[model samples]
Structures are given as structure tokens and as C-alpha cells.
Target: MWVVAQAPPETPVGPEFGKASPVGLFILVVLGVVILGIGYAFHRRLSRFNRRRLFAEQHGIDPFDREAIDAAMEEAGLRDLSRTSYL
Candidate 1:
């Protein structure tokens, strides 16, 4: 039969105990490292996408600007929307 004991007042840990078990500490460290690695990978991917979007918005003509696109279509001799299937 398991016997229940009353709690001690002075900190649950006794003076004899120096540190946590080695295996427990090792597991905690490994978990922390894995979490950090995953966070870094996600950060890098987001940064790359942000950079590409910024460059496109600055240098490339806005695809949403219908007037500009129409002007370009006229210049390329593709003014007819019905004939230009690529558009």
C-alpha cells in the first residue's frame, strides 16, 4: 500500500540535493535547441519573402495599374484584349 506523507515547510527540495538528475537536464537542453532551430528557420523564410515583395513593388510596374498595362499593350502591338490570350 502507498502511504501519504505531509508536506515539509522549508522548500520541497532538501539541502542534500545538489542539482536535478543529469538525464532530465539533458532532455530539457535538447528540447530548447530544437525549438530555437525551428524558430530561426521560420524567421529566415519570412525575411526572404518580404525582401522579394519589396523589390517587386519598387522596381516592377504595378500589375494592378490597368492604364499602365493598357499603354504597354498598345506599345507591344497587342492592344486587342480579345485576341491576346496571354493577358
Candidate 2:
């Protein structure tokens, strides 16, 4: 009588198998910085728009009229410059 021998199952085992590469960490850090930059830009734009809206409301300029609002804001800027003494 003869007996058959079966080989053991193949499985991965090593120090490098589950480790993350440096490139992956670099990409993650770059992505985070890019997201933060976009958020900052968006925040600046929204803040400027908010200032425009408040200015229009205070001076009774029609908020929807872009040209009028811009003209008024420009005049206001000149008026502010004239009133304030810069050293």
C-alpha cells in the first residue's frame, strides 16, 4: 500500500507585506495640504462676498446690481482713504 503526501497551503508572511510605503504617506500629506488650500481660498471669497452684501445693505445699494454696487464700494473706499491719515 502507498500513502500520498499533500503540500502545505501557500500564505504570505514577511516584515514588508503589510507595511505602507513612503510614497503613500507623501501623497496623503499632499492631499491634505491641497484640501486646506482650497478651503482657505473658499473662505476668503465668501468673506469678501459677505462684506459686499453688508456694505450694500448699509448704504441701500441694490445688491443684485453688480456695476452699481462696485461703483458705490469704490467711492466708499476713496472716502475712507480721505478720512483716514496713513503714516
Candidate 3:
């Protein structure tokens, strides 16, 4: 009786399949930076809007009116100053 010989299954090569390549990692990092930048910009815009809204409410003026905002700030002795002060 002749017996048939079976070949072993081939193993996958190359540092495991489905791993992220250098280019893919770079792309992901770039995407993350872009997303973060967009989020920061959105946060800054929202914060400014909210600040204006709150100021208007406190001063009983129209939030959309720039002249009213300026007048209110002047009346309240409020000035825009940089956070970092030089001595």
C-alpha cells in the first residue's frame, strides 16, 4: 500500500499582518494634528462667543451689536489686556 505525503501549511511572513506601516503612522499623526488644530480653533471661537454673550447679559446689551459691546466695556472700565504682563 502506497501512503500519500501531505505538505505543511504555509506560514504568513513580514512582522505580522495588518500592522501599521511608517507612512500610515505618519498619516495618522498628521490627521491627529489636524483634528486637534480644528478642535482648538472651534474651542476658541465658542469661548469668544460665550464670553460676548455673557458680557452682554451682564451689561443688558445686545450681544450682536459691536458698538453696544464697546460702550458697555468702556462704561464698566474694562480693557483688553494681554495675559502675560512685562515688568
TM-score of every model versus the real structure: 0.46, 0.73, 0.61
Model 1 C-alpha lDDT per residue in residues 1-83, reported as the tens digit of each score:
99889677675567766777889989999999989988987676666545444543665757466565556556656533323
Q: Which runs of model 3 end up more than 4 angstroms from their true locations?
A: 1-20, 74-87
For model 3, give the 10-residue run with minimal summed lDDT: 78-87
Worst 10 residues of 2 by lDDT: 78-87
Score each candidate by Cα lDDT: 0.61, 0.74, 0.74
**Error in Å for residue 80 of model 2:** 12
Candidate 2 per-residue C-alpha lDDT over 1-87 given as tens digits, one digit per residue, 9 for 90 to 100:
998887668856798788899999999999999999889877766766777778889999887877777788788763322223322
What lDDT is obtained when candidate 2 is compared to the true structure? 0.74
Candidate 3 per-residue lDDT, tens place, 30-54, comes to 9999999889877766776677688
Give Cα distance to truth, residue 81, candidate 3, Å: 8.5
Q: Write the candidate numbers in order of decreasing lDDT.
A: 3, 2, 1
What TM-score does candidate 1 reach? 0.46
How far out, in Å, is residue 66 in model 2? 1.3
RMSD of each: 13.4, 10.2, 9.6
Q: Higher TM-score: candidate 2 or 3?
A: 2
Count steric clashes of candidate 2.
0
